[model samples]
Target: MHQNPGGLSAAEIHTERKEQQRRRRNSLLLVVPILLFLFFAFVAPISSMLHRSIYNPTLVELIPDTINALSSWDRTGTPKPETLRTFSIELQQLAKQRESGRLASAVNRSYPGATSLINATARKLRNVDPNQLAQTGHLALLDTDPRWSETKLWQAIDRLGAKYRIDNYLTALDLERDAQGNIQKRQSSNIYIDLYSKTLSMSLIITLLCIALGYPVAYCLAHAPARIAGVLLVMVLLPFWTSFLVRTTAWIALLQTNGVINSVLQSVGIIHQPLELLYTPLATILAMTHILLPFMILPLYSVMKGIDPSHVKAALSLGSPPFSAFVRVYLPQTVPGLSAGSLLVFITAVGYYIIPALVGGTEGQMISNIIAYHMQQSNNWGLASALGSLLLAVIVILYWLYDRLVGASNLKLS
Candidate 1:
């Protein structure tokens, strides 16, 4: 071993090669568990959800014969008896598999006539032995039901069975389809679109309010003495230390008819009435602004803190107006923080549920409320998923747009 100090002997060279191979093998072994974890935990769930979104399980697997056979017919016209026969057989198989409910449910979503489609097929199936499903006479047995001759019924079945559709998207938009694939908005007076609009509008309003209030506060904190800044920052962070629900509940009590704000206002003769503040849009905006103000303040403070004080001093030395110097020199530097804070607050506010549910009126309730409604009140997973997916899409697009706009501006500056 001592003789191999300057150069590797054959045994030493082999040992070094073995050590390198062991490291490579260990690294590969380490990577495998991480990749497997990502696949199982993150990737698999997302793939499953996306699959569920387009998952038309009832028709595709059950009625393959009918879907394949009806490739040429117009939905508005009558279909031949052979098509009905194909559907009838598929329905019988589906019933045997205990999947007829899914078929009926899917058909009910697309067309009213198919309410009895599955039941009719099931009844016919009951009358005959399982071996007789292939017999020609089974077709006549199905023809007894008027749904068997309905072209739109078969079309709906085929769609629910075969199509990877935008129907869920339309439904989230409070729209639907007709027999000819034409889209129409829902005529219901109460719907998801209203909730969606309210959500966006409320979020935007809250974001603007946060910026207006938080900007000055953050500016003061940024330019203050270090001790003062520390105190203000501690105050800003204090809410975060408290439980979110506790803060929201505190707001509920404070905004109530006999609560502190109303009591003080009445004592000062500002208004005689409590003014319905607790369950109004004002309460939602106020509470959300209070809760989200720190989000706006911290980012703005970070940006403002990094700014050179001499920039404004230089502008002032050049005979620029104080306000003008501040606007010209100070405001542009804060864009990064402003954009960051707005994006954070808006994204969080849009998906807000608990705060709005507690303080928002019927008029102020957001889309998340409706999603929760469908999940808890209605137990309609498809509708809820459609809404959830749409909300997620909206957030994604908004973030993308924010990134592009901010990135472009940053590029121009550089």
Candidate 2:
């Protein structure tokens, strides 16, 4: 009931403050669910994957006493008597716990043939008396397997004993630590580096192809009459309406040696024999381009629709050639769309798994296929996580470069 000098009552001011607080509370309530969903669904999984890339605990947990003993021995010399005794006792306990396989599997990641040796030793130790093992020490272990005397096997065990390591990442990059602990290129044939290079190159080629094919379609859609433009836009987006798997399958059917495309070509007398099209890198590129073409077209169409045709006309009216007017005036205006579409297509193409895996035979497989192989077939989660993390890092770096060169704020989409 109290009136202020400005003619508003104190009650009115209190009501305004209460209304503002209520609105803020409602806004926060709406956002809380989305934030929780992101943390649990997206953020948490990525954090766990990144952590797995560096963390490994199977060996250390399975043979703690042995790891403790190895900590004291100089990796350069042969194992001491006490260290050997500790390793023997731990190996017996690990076998009794049925965990020798886990240890062997972990070791096999670094030294290929060590799994069989470790398993064999565990089997041999199962028959020997623990008391005899304690008494005989290093000699008993050597009788079980001469490889136990090898420094390299011990070195592999020592490496896995660490709870966290960079070995996964190093291996993903086709590099490893030598016996001297020096970082060096792996002795094995390098596959990861080549796969990474191929991934990048293919992504680049796909992005360029999408841009080349999408631009004309977008331009036509943007400039046509309203009814015509709507029809054209629908045609551009028709592929997206279909199932992705169906589209990929259709491409395989069309590109197969005796499939629709080859049949049409032969019917037209283009060739006597069918050309090998399916399961090739060219098929991968073509299918990916088709799958991603709409992404490019939508952004380009959105930008072109907003552009005033009069600007290009004004440039032409000033005596500039038509091509020159377009290059200098219209093309520059569409750059934001071009950049957004290219980045979207490139990033998506780099992570492509299904298309490349199904269409791309051995010669066309990408890094994502390798990651899947390690995860599912090899059961090498650490290596898979490392490859995924490296791919994520590459994407982040590319995004940072794009943002620096062409402001992310400039990106537009329909």
Candidate 3:
């Protein structure tokens, strides 16, 4: 029998290879469900958000012929008469379908009085015969609204007619391009940048507060007797058993002007009047810190549980000062958990919505509140997606900076 030196037979080796391939296929099959879940849950929504931020099809779909006609004419003046006639016919069709609302909204985002311009022209066009729309519809539209005579109105149509745009991102950043296409600060709606700063600042404060408050509790839980540690750990995790909304509303009761805290303070003679604490930034910070403190403590306690108490004792045995022993020998061991908990708390605090929305009055509203405003109230999903994409980018960049400078995965053991 002929065989390779390392194999019993070529057929045997081939059978083994088939067995390995089958195992590999089975392994992949086992994970396919999770992979599909991740793709649909995370990747799909993110892709949709990214696409919405740039590609809006409302204007392009509503008046494709009008946009195609405007393509030939320079944007320096009113579009050609044919383009106006085509736009009038499309508006008439949309009016018939009751779909003018979306177009009016899209147009108004770009140009003022766009609803009036589009709706009024639609009203005027219902009287025009569709067959004659190609002949005299442009004149009818001009008679309906003299604003159509203006260059800016046509410019907005031509701009929004394209399927892809960066205007949403520009507006999200409180910026705009001038007529000459130079990027400049927007005179109107110049609040997004400030909101981003406030969000980041508030998130940082919440992280720090979580650390200051959670670290001691975590250390105590880690070092206490097993019986006491189990009870303390329950206290830490007790918040999870309650509904999140219930927990947040409990703060509403505590911080409200005539609520438990104010009544207690008044009874104790600490103050005569109730404080305006419920709907302010301080309330946002405190509530968020409370909600996120357990995130810090749990990670810290987990890490601290595995840490050796003898490390600090050994440092003191070597004649090191107590503070020096704690800092130099013991503190390094907790860096992994500290970084993880900080990152968890900070990211959660940054994207927080319900807490801020419930308690954050006008003065305390964060960037997420503005994003919700754009999506829910204003129906400006493009701007909301752009803001969300920007927020995601900021968190990613900050994480990258942290990994580079602090190295979150850097585990030090001595």
Candidate 4:
């Protein structure tokens, strides 16, 4: 046989190394598109939304001097002469840039006296020496209106300077700021805390109802023979095959005073007249429970199926009562499924804007409907986004708490 080369050819070795490096680089390159896509799609939009929530432009850009001058003064009382000096400087700069309108609009957003202030300052500047204008004209201008020296105006300017503040968060909760920068409950007309409370309460109620209704059904399905369980599962899933809107509408027709339920009741002499069933909390709860029952059932069924039947028998043989056995053995085992189902149903219920809007009366409306109204009807993206972010934060905190509790329980069990 021909003798092989003792050492590899230099070209062959170089080619092999290069091939290996190319493969490694290609593997790294594969992640680039995915990262780029995520940034462009999800991160970019969310960042844009966060930016929009705190965005108030003209105060920071146009009136920096005012913000700085007010920084030294206490917000609880009337502002000093320095605050007036700052305003004069801001107005002069605005006049030079011909952007007085923008400055007016900014001030107008919070407190009154924007257009008159801007106009008066522009006119006053014409009579004073340009260099001495801020120092001299500022004091004289304040004498014209004592409201100019009031702390409320300075406080309003200060609010814009902080950029990121709890103001929007407080506002969403129907709280307002006083002249002293303290938050208090809003007037009855403006108060929306009730809506938030109602939304949370309704979600909890619906979740409880789902658990109560779905537990037995799920237990039966879990214990049945495989063939029987499959048939029952198909029946449970049949509602999902139909459009949600169609199902809701069908319920509306069925539950209406002149419709199937009331007609059947009246015919059977169950009541003197058709009960007011269509536009009440009862209707909303019943409809939501019907729709969400499957969410609870599926999770519990999955967990119950995974559980060995011998555990319950062992508990009974140990002299535990039937209910006690269930509480000690079966119930503890179903914690994971219960948690999963409750979280799913609760989160889903909290965001139920369309269902509540369509079926619920004034007293039954949730926070989501108000947020939607702000977004679509009023075009108040700031308020809408603030509310949405608050809701998201609340959900995240709840989930984190749930995870911690579950982890602790698992650790203890192990």
Best by lDDT: 2
Window of ten residues with lowest summed lDDT in model 2: 405-414
| Candidate 2 positional error at 3, Å | 9.1
Q: How far is 56's C-alpha from truth in model 2 (Å)?
A: 0.3
Please, what is the TM-score per model? 0.76, 0.93, 0.95, 0.72
Candidate 1 residue spans exceeding 4 A from truth: 1-48, 62-74, 82-99, 112-150, 183-194, 256-274, 372-386, 412-414
Better of 1 and 4 by lDDT: 1
Error of 2 at 208 (Å): 0.6
Most TM-score-accurate candidate: 3
Segments in model 2 whose C-alpha atoms lie over 4 Å from true places: 1-18, 408-414
Winner on TM-score between 1 and 2 is: 2
In candidate 3, where is summed lDDT lowest over 10 consecutive residues? 405-414
Cα lDDT for residue 220, model 1?
93
lDDT of 4 at 249: 92
Per residue, candidate 2 scores C-alpha lDDT tens digits across 135-171 of 7867878887787888888888898899899999999
Q: Report lDDT (CA) for all predictions.
A: 0.80, 0.90, 0.89, 0.79
**Per-residue C-alpha lDDT of model 1 across residues 1-414, encoded as one tens digit per residue:** 544665878788889999999999999998999999999997887676566566555566667787887876667666666675666677667767777776676677778756576666676675555456556634654466655666677667666766577676677887877767788877666477777787888899999999999999999999899999999999999999999999999988999999999999999999998868888888888999999999999999999999999999999999999999989888888999999999999999999898888998786678988888977976556667778888888899989998899979967765
Clashes of each: 1, 0, 0, 0
lDDT of 4: 0.79
The CA lDDT at 123 in model 4 is 61
